[model samples]
Target: MLTRPISEGNLLTEHNVHQNYRPDVDGLRAIAILGVLGYHAFPGEVPGGFLGVDVFFVISGYLISTIIFRSLEQKKFSFAEFYAHRIRRIFPALILVLIVSLLIARNVMLPNEFAVFGRHAAAGAGFVENFVLWRESSYFDVATTLKPLMHLWSLAIEEQFYLVFPIISWLAWRTRLKWPLLVAAIGLISFLVYVFSSPISAFFSPLSRAWELMLGAACACLAPKILAPKSAGRSFYGSSFSILGLFLIGLSFFGSLTTSLFARPVLINVMATLGTALLILSGPAASLNRLLLSTRPFVFVGLISYPLYLWHWPIFSFWTIIEGKSIDLTSRVLAVSLSLALAWLTFQFVEYPIRTNKRAKFRLATGLAGFMALAVALGLTAGHWGRHYDANIQKIIDAWDFAGYPEPPGAFHDPKYNFVSWRANTENEILLIGDSHAEQYINAIVASLNSSADRPSPQLMFYSVMSRFGIPQDLLNKIANDQAITRVVVSYFWSIKYGSPKIDYEIRCCGTGLFQTVGTKGGSSPSENEMRSLDAELEQLLTALRRDGREVDVILDNPFGSDLAPRSLVRRNILSGIQINAGVALSRAEAIERTEPYRSRVREIATRVGARVIDPMDSLCNDTGCPAITSDGFPVLKDYDHLSLSTLIHHVGYLNFLR
Candidate 1:
């Protein structure tokens, strides 16, 4: 599951002293790999199938610990030999995948995307992929399917564990410490960290994830004592335990569990880990183990599971990148089929020869190491010089880097309240408050002020936080007491703030970034309660500002869709080698239908509170559709929704209200 094959002598062996292969364990590997494939390809049907990774952790931990414990007992454990074997097993398929991915990325990806991919590739080769992904694990980060090397995080964690756990095993054996006790102690500490840490940390941190692997290691330590020629009732107990384990694993895979690991309950992972341990403990003679797992088909899949895991995600991801959206069901199935074929070929031709060639083991290890180093260098070079091979594509990608508008020279930073203010020599100031949507208007506001030098500009104070639902009491008091602040503007991604879909809260620095956990496509209609809450909040805030005779304006959210993204405008068919220029537009009718509920509610609240309403749709949309790219070839929206920097400079007249 970590993309390392379980070779016959080391992992598949079950006896304490002998090297007898266990085909049932290979069958278990087959299950884990298939679940992962299902989760990646058809997530809706197998919502919890991602839990297969946790199962893999247990399998890897158990097998690796078995090898270490057996080797230590035999007094033949050499770290050099152990690491060399690991290199031989891990590098063959991984090297091929990384090189192929880089080549494909160079030809197809945009400059910024290629830069990101290059960084991921370097991290993958250096075994630091987990750390890189952990840093970038944010709600605002790009979608998972768009990241080709995202799956490498698990492999990196496994490698890190292999590096540390062996030394711990040796130290414990050297000091005469009980292996089970040591594993339990370390696993307990890791479980505590996993439970208490931030979601992103819990998901990606090797420290937090160690307990799952240790669970497998614990099984290895205890199995011999627990199963040493036990009574006749042992068979009955094994069958029951194995059935229970299968049930738990099945529930995890098919149940209506949340797909977002960050938001999913910890019980899901616990169930999967416990289930995997149960199945492994059930042994080869158990009814399900012998009848189901040891079958020829399952064993074959398990044999190639390492390569299958390595090959599947990139194939799916590259298809998504080329299509500029989620691939169709047919495409996903085809991708899986292709991944299976490639995985088999890689296993037979690449992995088997390198792993089994006894005479050339040293040469193969050294050569693999050198190739890995080369991969690191090429990845770094690609990141540094993100020059696309195609000139026309490179020119189109150059337009993606839209620079931000600079803050005014006389801006004041309020550390206590965490807001920025642009002070002008004027009698009154305009306060802009909300989330990032409010922040996006700063560029247009500055441009408007600069264009109107004939008149005095109002002092500008911007509070870019989630103030739409609940304004900070301190900031509200500041606005109330400060008479110089004569006008207020409110803006937010209204649908996200009041959308009916289940909210998955994510910590975004000082405030939470609200994300709808419905699906990747779109969201459901706003609930009545959400609409009413928004109305009440807006009315309360507007009335408070109006009580002091200050003007208030509510700017509606901009029209947005995946089709309106710049990347979606340019697409490539990798197979056909054809480039297609897809038009970037969202239907005007659809935009209105999406926003009308919140728009009408905000309008009613503002009218009642004596505040004005500003609609961006008037400037952004036409009779036909809302276009993302301007007529002159400039991108209007930076991503999906937010106005681009170019839009701020070129279309400042839309914010005449600010002037």
Candidate 2:
């Protein structure tokens, strides 16, 4: 039987190693796990449910510290045993989850996607999921929704803490000093640095997250010394305090606190630390501990929390992938039931036996290592198999002669113009400027112009399309000098240009002083500003390009509401008399209507600046409407309002203006 007042430790309350463990501590885990689940299941229902992770950090600190302090105080600290227990507890379930997920994923994922899954699995096994995720989270990629192992980042943080904290606690015990104070200070500093970086970086960085874990460690160090009956503040109002703390936690979940609100990420770290401390510290108070967290239901959920957390996200993610859409109400309910059932089974069959039995733990670890190695090998082989298939597919595409030739150098040949493929004759020099939309057409225009042997090879150069106007400050300085021999073509996505009524132009303007500073430093000719201020910069660029022995051609932006669905599917649906959603079909149709107003704006600006506006609205829209998909079964848009590569190639003739 476990004894009471197990040992006299610095932080351990008078209770010995054999003393009864607090059931309410598990109840707090119950609260944390449930809050997180509720948030993921129905985001709007509990927006702050993410705070549950904070609560977990605090509880972990309390319990783990209690155990460590007692062992150290009794001069029985065993690093080997501690680590063994940790490995047994954490890795078995995690490896099992990853293996199962990889097996399921291989059946349906694309070869490239499967390769990605394998990589994540390997990374998770290596305990660096957070680093993998941090590197990948950017606007250029679909970062968040894709990774099934994304949630493993928190566990990784905890594991890291577990590794470092034991060593630190051991050192502090040997020194008989307040070494935890030094640790807390370091954690605070690291958290500050994390908050200073990008939000995603702060979210993933181990250094940044260390404070939350350290907060728990500190509480563990302090709890015993402070809670002793002889201590000055040892008056027991445990039940009331626990109730108040739980209420605060609940209140926190209902509030609108978000990562976005924190000016510094460290602020959130601090808040989580404080909140967790209060909750954990109040847990063992008999009056509160008995009534609140001791409830059987709360304790039961806490027991199964680890398995439930592990299983939920993957099931949800896979369901979304297989359904090719989000889950509706019934599906969500079913998903929940399935998740719960799996959690219960895993707990009963796997976690419980391994945890309670020493020999069973050893067997379980051996079996898991074998299974994981087999799964990884199989996953790798599948990837190899898929790559071979893809290479063959590429060969077929080459055989079909779908792969095109490369274009030559000059303005049109510049890599900047490669995406757009703008073609030019020997008689004309073209300048393409604007955002990505304008830059995208350079290659087509250049290729189309080059295709004609009769036409003089025209030169083309594309400026930064994302620049606020045709002229960024860097280019503005250059254009004032370097009188390049002649014709100027300005092609930009004018609809999304700076000074548009919808977008704030000031915010859009970047790199304005770069060109001017370059000019002042004798880097190039002094750039003449036709429009002295940002508002008139576009018109100024047009006039300046003309003044310096150049003619200007401004390509108008394309239709704005293109969908990603294949054009062939859309046309086939129409022919088959199948009804599609009115919202999707009409959005494109409405986009076509907006062209006239956009055209008028372009014409008004072009007329004033003596530039010609090349509008492709007529080519894109038919009498009935603007088609989302092409007749050949290609998606017109890659995303909400931009054309896909195939869509751009099909409309290569739209570059006639460049010729």
Candidate 3:
């Protein structure tokens, strides 16, 4: 998230970045970046943590707009010069982090994951990550946490604003229009677009987001008239505005989630933007500006904030992927600490040395241009390479069928099926319903009962509420209408429907269970109220099914946390080779423990609903732990969780549950 440019206030120094440097602005920069860091590392701890990006946008607008205004007034404005400063400010640290994250990705990422990283990395280099992500993301697809370069979306918006807006401002200022009023008008329109436009446009459209930055630009354009030296330095209005500014910025932290769903054009986002503007106009002479906001520690963070932002996300994302769970508090802290240290190193060794040297401008331009070329090549090559690799991964996945039953098309047709295919089985005695994880075992179930009198046919829900609620009424009616259907096997990954607090919300859809009546965002643990609602709904559903004389069985969630799977017990052979977090084998108790709270809770719900609990570990685990690898040594879990069909059929007792 660094060579994310630092405070716009500091940019006035590019004619010299250090000589005219304002420490108070650096403090503000520190606040914005820290808020972001806190939000990423611990989202529930800071639900509105994303408002920090809005804060940065305002600071950038103020600083860049100020530079342009002064140059234009003196009749010496130059687009070449403005963009040169941007390159110096943004390119060096950005390239450094891109290289660093790619190195890590090559070492650990699955072929598919690495390919996605490459694609987004290329987008980041081109300053269009926002568009790529916008195009890629859907309401139910491409979740934010899954994207390693996700935070770069804001940077794309910021950089695009820099590229396009200054020219418009220059033209408008050259006209009879008052510069401040024109900018404010544009800001008002943009804010309206953000509020009224579709959410996709609001999230990714530069037009919608530009207003936050323009608010800063307006303050810069009007500052000289409204906050003259004598008036700013000694006026009581300066101190009062500065104090109000600080309060509003702080308020977004506590009261943002309720201020509409998207993290833009909302009351809290506007508050943070206006807050930054007020502080900038308050003049450095304002006491609050100099005393608390300009403290050395804050300024220090600001100094390295760009690189810190760049490094933190990839580190946190990769770590979460490897751990296969929500980052515990300790791991989150460690990731942040490592990010700070690496950022400091990158800033000192890469950004500072190159950006500060006037004589190095030619060298800086050449280096960045070359680096840009390399980043693009690296991205394309990685993607091409991973594409080949994924072909093999898919082939392996294709082979995950049972001994006798052939795997159906991974994707299917039919409106009733929705996304995946759902054929009424020759028997149609058992209806398998849920998301993708629920589909993983269908082949195994089919193989076990291929010739049995009662066969389990899959009715894929594919996605949770985002598609349809648990087992759509249509599918239920189909089952109810089938006289041959004597049993209903309700198996789903409950965690997918009801997100787990154990996983970060950015990575997950939501923590609320599928049965929950009240919906909430993806940051905190599921509320007791939601859980109660879920249980009540399940009870009612089960009651209805029993009244129809059909036996019901609910499969609990599978134990997750195997991103570091394929674990080998013998880290060091007799020859003493060192091994890290390699292939892992977990016990039965630990497997059950891993699925806890939700696992136990699901078990309770099943008991209450008179449904039998079909726990997979009964077959996979005995008195000992569940071995991650089979005796033949193939890893049991394919990715983080879902067992391959062969593993489930051969080892996990797919036949027992059918009866």
lDDT of 3 by residue, 1-659 (tens): 33433343333344312214567788888889888998988777677677888889988888877777777776767776677778888999998888877776665555555787898899888889999977865443443554668788888998998898778877877785677777878898998999998877888889899898888888777777776666574478888888988888877765655555435447777787888888888877777788877777787898888888888988887676555445789999999999999988989788876776667665677779788789978987895664233333343434322212345644354453344333444344455555556677666665555435464443322322333234566755665665655666666666655556553233222222111102333456678887777767666656666555678778776655433133222131212222333345676766766566778777887787788888777766656677665665455665445675557667767445464
Least accurate 10 contiguous residues by lDDT in model 3: 509-518
Q: Supply the TM-score for candidate 3.
A: 0.73
lDDT of 2 at 341: 82
Cα lDDT, model 1, residue 77: 80
Candidate 2 residue-wise lDDT, 1-659, digit = tens? 11121111221222223224666777777888888888778777776677788778777666666667777888877776566566666676777798788766665454555687887777676667788888876433342444666787878777777888788788888988564775577567876777677877777887877766667767777766655653222245554556666666766665544445544434444554575676666546545456666677777777777888888888877665554345677777787788788877887777665655545544655665666576556555556753223332222222211112233455234443343324443334555566666655656666666666585666666665576664455665555443542555565555454223332221121211110011111122112342234436666667776675456667666665323232112211111221222223334456645444445655677778777667666666667666655565444554434454655666646676555
For model 1, the stretches where C-alpha displacement exceeds 4 angstroms are 1-6, 10-18, 224-234, 237-241, 255-266, 389-409, 413-419, 433-435, 454-456, 463-465, 469-557, 575-582, 587-590, 600-614, 622-624, 656-659
Cand. 3 Cα-lDDT: 0.67
Winner on lDDT (1 vs 3): 1
Instruction: Give the best candidate by TM-score.
Output: 1
Candidate 2 Cα misplacement greater than 4 A, ranges: 1-20, 171-198, 225-236, 257-268, 286-288, 322-337, 372-382, 385-427, 470-487, 498-551, 560-562, 565-588, 594-600, 607-611, 620-634
User: What's the residue-level lDDT of 163 in candidate 2?
Assistant: 86
Q: After superposition, how far is residue 117 of candidate 3 from its true place, in Å?
A: 1.4
User: In candidate 1, how many Å is residue 200 off?
Assistant: 3.0
